[model samples]
Target: MKKLIWLVFACMLALPGYSQESATRGTANNVRQPNVIVVPYAKEGQDVRQLIENNPLVSRAVSKVKEEFGNRGFTTKDFVTLLKASKRNDIISATTGAKSDPVKDVVLESKADISVEVKIFVNKHANGSSEVSLELQAAEAISGESFANASYTSDKFITQDSLKLAERALGKVNDDFFTQLQNGFNEMMEKGRNLNVRIELGPNSGIDPYTEMKTGNDLETELQDWLSNNSYGGNYDINSSDMVIDISMKVPIYDQVSGKPYNVTKVRGPLISFLKGLLTSEEHEPKTKASSGQQIWIVIQ
Candidate 1:
C-alpha cells in the first residue's frame, strides 16, 4: 500500500512539470517572428548605396549580421536588392513629378518588420595591431522607433581582416542583442503597432466641425466614431480643433482577414474612403498626401 501511494504521489508531481513544458512550447509556437533587414549605416549627406558599394568592411558586416539573423530562424531581407528596386522606381516617380524619399521607399517596399543599421570602425596601433568595433541599431520599419542597439570592440589582432574582426566583436553580444530585439517585437505584437494620422481642412473646404453629416451626426462625432471603430481595441488618443484632427492610434500588427503584416498603404485607403462619404459636394474632395514614416496626412478640400 505504501508503494502504491508513493507511485500516485510521483505521478502527481510529474503532471505539473509536463504541463509547464507544454505551455512553454505553446508560447514559443504562438510568438510571431518579425522579418528583418540589415543595412549599412550612412551619415548625413552620404548615400547608403554608395557606402555599401565603396566600403568592403561595411558590406561584410552587413552580411554577417544578416546571416546571424537567418541562423536564428528569423527571415532576413536583402538591402542591396531592395535598394536597387527602389532606385528604379525613383526614376519613374521623378518623371511623373512625384516626390521621392529613398530611405522610406526602400523600407516600405521591402516590407521588413525591423530595419537594422550597421556601422563598423577600425583603428590601427603603432605596434601593427588593429582593433575593430561594430555598432548595430534596430528600429521598427514603419514607426522608426528604435528597439535594440549593440556596440562591441574586438581585441587587438595582427591580422587586418575586418570581416574576421567584426565577427569576433559581434559574437560577444549576439545573444543579448537578439534577446532585446525579439522582446521588443513581441511587446509590439501584443500591444499593436502605432500609427499617427493628421486630418486638416484645406482652404475653401465646405465642411466644419459642427456640420451635420448624412448619418445625422455632426462631422466631429462622425470622425471620432470612425477612429474608434477602426483602431485596435478602440485604443487611441486624439487632439482636435476646428480645422484639424491629429490622432495617434494603435493598429493591429497584422490584418485579421489576410493574416499579413499591415503597412501605411493599407490603412490609408479605408480612411480616404470614409472621408469621401462625408463630402456633400463635388467641389470638395478628400485628398491624401504622402506618408512620412508612420504618419499620414489628409486634407479635405
Candidate 2:
C-alpha cells in the first residue's frame, strides 16, 4: 500500500503541468489573469499635497480610472501596486489578464502628458523698451507616473497677460491629458493571437477517405473562415497569401469486371460542421430536467 502511494506521488512530481507553471504578473489572489496600474506625473518636488485635497479634476480622473480598471479584473490595491511599480513613461508595458508580458512584437506607451504654454509680453514701464516676453506652464494634481518626464510643449497662446496666460495653459494641459487617456483606453483590444494547427488523415477504413477536391480562387470569405477556425494570425488575400491545404485521395476499390478503379463516394455527415461549438455548447441542446426511468401523463375524460 505504501509503495503504491509513493508511485502516485512520484507521477505527480514528474508531470510537467503539476511541477512547472508559466509565470504571470499582476494577478492578485494568486489566480490567473493580468493586472492594470495607473500612475500620475507631477512637478518634481512640487508642493501639491494640498492641491489634491482641493482639486476636482485630479480626483475625478483618479476615480474614473479606478472604477473602470477595477471592473476589468483590477483591484484598487493592485492598481496602487501597479501605479507604484510602473514607470510614468511606460503605460503601454501593461501586463495584466491571461498573458504575462504579453505585449509581443510591439511596444505601447499609454501615458499622456498635457503641456500648455502661455506666451505673453509684460510691460514694466510705459516706455515701449520696457517689454519682456514670459512663458509659463503648469499641470494639475496628477498622481500617475505618466506625467513625470513627459515631453510636450504647446504653441497655442492662452492669453496676452502673464498670470492669465499661465492659468490658461494649465487648463489646456489638464483637459488634453484627460481626453487622451479616455480615448487611449476606449480603443484598446488585444491583437489576434496565433494558434498553430495541422490536420492529418489516417488511412480510411469504412469511410474510405479517398475522395479529394481542390479549392480554386479562394476569396476573402474563405480565407477569413479558415483563419478563424485554425487560429491563424496573419492577414492577406487567401488567393494571394495563405491558402488551404490541397488534398488528393485515391479510390480504394477497383471494379471487378471493368478492370478499373471505382469513382469515389463522399460521406455527407457535415464534416464542415468543422469542429464547431468549441467556445460553447450553444449549438447543442441544453440538458432538460427529465427523469430517466419514469414518465408522468394525465388523461382527461
Best by lDDT: 1
- lDDT string for model 2 (1-301, tens) is 9999999999986764354321111111122222233333233332233323454434333444445445554433322233335543223233333232211101112221222222233445434223333332322111111222212222344334444433333333334543443333222211111111222222221111122213322223442455444321232122222222222111112222342322221111121233222212333321222211111111101
TM-score quality measure for candidate 1: 0.74
TM-score for each prediction? 0.74, 0.21
What candidate 1 gets wrong by more than 4 Å, as runs, is 1-29, 84-101, 122-131, 155-165, 206-218, 263-266, 276-282, 291-293
Top candidate on TM-score is: 1
Tens digit of lDDT per residue, candidate 1, span 58-83? 88888889989999999999988777
Task: Tell how far residue 49 is off in model 1, in angstroms.
Answer: 2.7
What TM-score does candidate 2 get on C-alpha atoms? 0.21
**lDDT for residue 224 in candidate 2, whole number 0-100:** 48
